[model samples]
Target: MVRWVRALVVGAALAGMITLAGVVLGRIYADPLLVRLVAGAAIGSVGLSVGMRRLPNWTVAPLSATVLGAYTIVGLKLAAGQADVTGPLSQIARDSLVNGIPRLLTAMIPVQPAPDTVVVPVIAAWLAGLAAAEVAVRARRVLLGLLPVVALYAGALYVVGPNASAAGWTTPAFAGLAIVALATSARPAHAEVPEVSAKLRGRAMAGAAAGLVAVIALGAAVGPWVGGQVSASPVDPRRYVQPPQVDSLDESPLNRISGWALSPEQRLFEVSPTGAKSRTVRLRLAVLPDYDGITWRVGATYRNAGRVLPQLPRLPDATTADVRQEIVIDGLTGRLLPVVPTPTEITGARIAFDAATGTLIRPEQLSTGLRYSVVSEVQTPDVNLLPAADVPSGNAVARFLAVGPGVPERIQRLADQLADGNGAAFDRATAIEEFLAEHYRKVADAPSGHAYPNLDFFLFGPRAQGGQVGTSEQFAASFALLARLTGLPSRVVVGFDAPAGGGAVTAGNAIAWPEVLFNDLGWVAFDPMPKSKNPRPVEEDFTPKPTKPPTPPSEPPTSADTSSSSAPPAALAAATDGGPGAAVIAGGASGSVVLLLAGLALALVVMRRGLSRRRLTVGTPDERIGGAWAELRDALRLSGRPLPAHLAATEAAAYAKEPSAVRIRRAAPASEAAPLPPLDELVAGINTVGFAPGAADDAQADRAGSQAVAYATALRARRSWWRRVWWSLHPGPLRWRRPL
Candidate 1:
């Protein structure tokens, strides 16, 4: 009875721990089926392992494996709707083994509860329960049994990353169960404790009570400090793993803008509101952020995603409302999926989404009649914040500021002239819009080209030279480049301006526009298209409101005039107008600067690593001990804390109390950054080698180096992430004027 009761306690505790660990998968998976599968696996594995405890240990493992295999196979098979015995059970099991792990890692959060997705969590729970049960019941090692459960829990947390955190009760619940198992296994099954003398028992009880009290007091003193010092931003493990690449993303959807314009009356896609009220919905198909003088393309990494998309890092001061649209593809042909900006949820089709660009793509090509529903978090910026908004510096948004080579001098000067009086980024953007709308003509049949030459002709070339007329393609491309020249981060969005209340979207509704990034207002859209004076031609393409035709340039260029311009020296053109040779020289210089910086950083790291290695290995025992202390001081220097050459080891460690050093003396307010006692002990060893010892042995030297390495590691870990990166790259320690 006593053995049976002990087994029951072990089984119950292991089951609780395994189940709790499995439930952490809720962060990544939304399906209730996953929770149920994990729970069943945990309970079954624990029960079977405990029941077969009387059997030989080797046999018990085989039995547990057989049981788990059968359970997992049947569960997966039934979930896949292939319950027939004659069906491909072996292949189902094989695919699950082969593809399951990768699927879990790459699948988007709130993952669909499919057979492959559920297999990993179910197997994990069963193995944890089985291994934990065997150790606790047969081996009689309760605390050791907690290893599998702890490993499972940690793996789940890492896989979830910053997606979601476990609930409040989970930590306490696991801790409580672990304690119960430890207490139950403290004594032998069916054995009685020998009675102790009253005096001895009293002393033992008091000692236990005192130890418990000390632990409680320590926790109370340190808990809040530890919590406060933890980084506000959790390190996301997924960043280290590369997102799966798609080949379809290479084909720029911006190229389709021309084709859509050519067939204006053709139906493209239709949008219907899922909500009661209907409003105008502007769907963005793709964002073109990269241009290479030839064509524009998307510069975003699309990852496989589920219904709930990742949240943005910062939410500007804006009124955000959820707008749901049921969209149907009509004649739109491409892999790119049109979506309202900042989609929160998508259903009815599989997709790869880029959160940064708010773009979506169907890995599978879109066909006529394909349907999907999207819930978008539409933001309306606070208008009052617009005027005060400042554009980010060029360094901060270099990608958007980038323009290809061979930009005309006239274009740059024109951008400067138009933006000269505008004090704010928004004002400059608006100035460009007002100038374009007032001066340019927007013809429906304007030839499609957005290259430098095309825009050059549109802006400055004489009308007799086929200049000054084009579509939204020209208007938007020109505006975006000009905005970038004026120091505003800008990107062109290609999509359709669907009718208000959402119905049939035709190619005639297609439009492209430029958006400028503002500090507090986010990407604000600007209209540079000239207003249409002509009434809409029913069943035809939408034409922008036309302005009076732009005046011809003062002097129409003749062949003689062209020849005069071309007569300039190639070197002069390169110097004056940013020609091919200038571009090459500029690129080469920039590349050289980057290489120099990288080489400097590599040199610093190599020198620091070599210095520490030589300190431990190459020097005499006594000298090595001294080198260890030097290495510790070097690490401290990396943190930007000064340690004077005259100071003793102990004095130096104490004086180096810059917040991240985990100071030995309590100079700061009570927090997690309190003194490190290990540093004091290491300092004592340094003092002994330098002052008291005649000679230090090899073991003593090795120990000193090891301890110094540890202390330095802890000091480095306490600093912020960017500071740590700088600490590795800094040459301050290597260049110290005088080594201590």
Candidate 2:
């Protein structure tokens, strides 16, 4: 009976190891690892139970376990509609095998597998378990039994390399545990049989264990470095990624933002703002008000900017210019055609407009060589003549003020701090604009992920701190987010920034800025990011107009500032001026790479911790106990000795066939963790919990859980500093798992 129990326990340990290894999918799947561990437990227990029964053929028990485990997983997913349960059995098999192939191929890892799609992995895992059980129990060979598990681990390693190290050693861990269980349980088929002495057997086990640990250590430490060396040099993936298709099947103007930011050589088009135009001109693509905390996108559909195209909103007493800008599209391809803000008329075939943004749209997919001319009525408002922002009666006002989800609380506070309480909206607007210009820096490159993930990282992520967020999009998005919190209507504008000589707009000139809406000035643009000086005028030509040679300054130019003979360098002076286009992008290319790498690392830590917590609280009574057990292993990995990959929990604890780190000192040298009676009790209580049919009870399960909590606290209290940092990334259960 004791031997059978030991075999079963080892089987369970193997299950755990494979499950942990399987968690590599967490990075790819949206669903958590808790869901997949179900299959791990089912496979392990079934194999062990059938084997312990002394079933007829060794293959019989393993094959039965494999079939049973596979069916159970498929049945569960089928019930969930992950796979089609309505289809004939053969058809379901065909779909799971055939249709699932491509999905598994292109599918990213650690991903949440689909109902039907996950079937393949589940079956693959079953086969692995079957092979493992046959070797370990029937053939009774440790290395061969571990082969299938090793294959799974190696495959996971090849797929993600070091990135999957968070759960890297599960296979060896369980296999060692299984070997110990079998060794301890062995009493020979015949009592008279003599075999290798106990010491030699022990030495063999030790050598095998040492080899496994060495293999894992090398792979974990050296694999990524090797992979990096062999692979192409690291480049920011976002640099190559096309613009985001903002919430539509068809591309929106915003979709091309990243491409524009990354490309400086390619020209999107040339804007001739031909006649009767202000010195400064900004082409409008989209005016977005709907911010779902991640992206800014237009919620409303297209309407005519005017009966014809490019019509500006009529403002009372506002000086309007009847201007014409001829735009010649280049390499850019999109359904949305770029236009200057407030065009009075646009001449083109198949052009539409969204008055919401004063943008022109081409319904068809864009092709090169597209041309359009716009006749616009632009409102040129000077600060002195413009009215102070006052209350406006417009539907647009409310939409602009609506704040999205992830606007950090600190940003809102900063906005309030900078804005004057008694001043009009314009005063607040100026203050905010100036605040961004002075406080926020601009970089030429765009950062990936949502603009602001961890505010601390964005605000103080780099060693440079204040200067890290230096990009037009960052400047514009941050300003818009803050302005909305300040009770002003704000949105981000993305469009081509025509060079000063208004001849052509290159991809480099694709810039973004904030536009705040006021009752007095409709969507007024604010340039918070610095850019190069535009020529005095973006006109047809700057050829020196025939000038009377040398009229010279009226008098020898007297020193403008007599007190200051030494002026600041051009770059330093420009940076200190605190205006849009004042500061050059700081290591814009490298900054993006740093941000991407940092974000990826942070995300991995967060997901690992969250999964650890979720695994503890979620599952059936047996499953919950299993979760707590897994959490204990995670905790031990930090505070206790670094678990050797080949050592099962008991072996690592320096014991045989005993689960849990019953004696912490064995795994942790000089360990001061107090004896946890509850831990021992919990381990003993769960001896039957879900290991076999009808082996669990409410009382046993509850006691085991309380003991787990007690043990966890005691174990974690004694961790070293480095371990404590690791522990932070493995958060505890703060909330009870909702019943699944």
Cα RMSD (angstroms) for every candidate in the order listed: 22.9, 30.7
Candidate 1 lDDT (Cα, 0 to 1)? 0.74
TM-score of every prediction relative to native: 0.60, 0.37
lDDT of 2 by residue, 168-269 (tens): 355457557656755754665533324756667688899999999999999999999898875544332223323223336233345455556676788677
**Per-residue accuracy of model 1 over 678-718 as CA lDDT, tens digit each:** 66545766777767775567887788788788777767766
Q: Residue 620 of candidate 2: its Cα lDDT?
A: 63
lDDT of 1 at 534: 39
CA lDDT, every prediction? 0.74, 0.55
Off by more than 4 A, model 2: 1-255, 276-280, 303-307, 310-313, 385-387, 393-396, 420-422, 449-451, 454-456, 465-467, 499-502, 530-740
How many angstroms is residue 100 displaced in model 2 relative to the true structure, after the best TM-score fit?
42
